[model samples]
Every structure is written in C-alpha cells, then in structure tokens.
Target: MYSKGWIMMELTMNWITLRVRNLEASLDFYHRILGLPVERRFESRGKQIVMLGIEGQPKLELIEGSDPPVKPECGVSVGFEVASLDKAMAELAKEGIPVARGPIAPNPSLRFFYILDPDGFEVQLAEHM
Candidate 1:
C-alpha cells in the first residue's frame, strides 16, 4: 500500500504533435519565424516527424501528412509565452504574417494575440505584465 504522502507515479507533459501538410512551410513558420530549434527528427511508416523544443522541456512535434490535410477542429489553440509582445508582433509583421485575432489584454497583468499556422491551427503569443 502507498502512504498518503508518498507518490506511486509521476506524470509530466511529453510533447504536442501537429499534423502538417507542408513540412517546409511548417518548418519556416515554427523554426525561422518563431525561433524554435529542432530537437530531433525521424521517420516512421513512411511519414516524417520533426520535434522542436528547448532542453529538458516538452516539445512540439510536426508530422508530415498528406497534402491538403484534414482541417483542425475549431477553437483549439496552443500558446507560447514571449518576453516582449511588442517585439514579437513587430517581427511577425516584418515576416508578413498577419495577426488572426487579438492583441487584447483581458486583464492588466496579461496581453496576448493569435496567429494562424500553415495548417490553419491557432498559435497564440502572450506576455505577462
């Protein structure tokens, strides 16, 4: 039997996987645009997979799928924290990547905005005040 204060098993987030139609486009956005470094890459069952993240953290995996991949569900998004929202926004604008939604601050302590990835999945960039 396990004691009240003892843990039997610990859980942690491993990674988030996104199916992408164009691997080059996805890499351009995620690597060049957002500045995520590629952790590793491999192939399985005729499909290529690329993982990106910092050391000792959960990764973002992009799996190469069929051209014209299936549409992602509505209202699902992944958010990343930025040191400066204004700088990030400026960089994005320089790249000609339009903001799909808000640079809205619902509260004084937070500000955020959304952009669409190549596959039309929502990607959010936020900064804490």
Candidate 2:
C-alpha cells in the first residue's frame, strides 16, 4: 500500500561552484579580501577546486575551468552581508584593495560598498543597523 501522509524532499544545492580563470587568485580574493576560510581543497580530473567557509556555514567551490563565463556587469550581484562596513573598508584599504564604490549610507538603517574581484566580478559589502 502507498503512504498518503509522507512528504517528499526535493534536491537542493550542497555547494555553489564558480568557474574561474585562475583558481589560486580567485581563492585568494575570497579568503583574503572577502574573509572566507578554506574549508577543503583537492583536485579532480586534472582540475582544482577550492571550497571556502565562513564561520560555521557551508562554503563555495571555486573551480578551474577552460572557458570562464563573462559575468554580467549589472545583474545578480554577489552580496556579502558584513558585520561592519567601516571595518571591512579599513581592512581592504590596508591591503591596497580599493572599492569601486565607497561605503555609503543610503538611508538611516543601511550601508554598503562595492569592489571587484580579480576576475572583475562585483562584490557588495552590506551592513544593517
């Protein structure tokens, strides 16, 4: 007999893998600039993929690919919700990393900044009060 009260689970993303041109450079941006830690790294099929973790959260996999996609200029921005916009900007400035857009208080309750990764991908640093 078939069950009538069971709920089916759907497939979900365990990790997000970004195809990048340079694996090491991409990893460094995420680790150094973005402040993500390397959770695990290994190789498969002669290609390398590095997984990054932020605190206790599951991380992203930066994979080396032959033909990297040209990431959209003004769409689907990868936003990193930060603890402090000033702190983040300070750290980035110390490392000689300049934000394309400096920290701005758009309103009384929020602020954000923007920077480009080595591959020219946009990263938005957001803070909420």
Which candidate has the highest TM-score of all?
A: 1
Q: What is the TM-score of each candidate against the true structure?
A: 0.88, 0.78
- Reference-based TM-score, model 1: 0.88
Q: Judged by lDDT against the true structure, how good is candidate 1?
A: 0.89
Name model 1 segments beyond 4 Å from true.
1-9, 67-70
Per-residue alpha-carbon lDDT of model 2 for 17-103, expressed as tens digits? 577888888988998768788888899888888988775665677888776556747354567788888999999988888988767
Candidate 2 wrongly placed segments (more than 4 Å) = 1-13, 55-58, 72-74
Q: What digit string (tens of lDDT, one per residue) describes model 1 on residues 31-97?
A: 9999999999899889889999888989999999664565666566778999999999999999999
Q: Which one wins on lDDT?
A: 1
lDDT of 2 at 107: 95
Worst lDDT run of 10 residues, candidate 1, spans 2-11
**Cα-based lDDT at residue 15, candidate 2:** 67
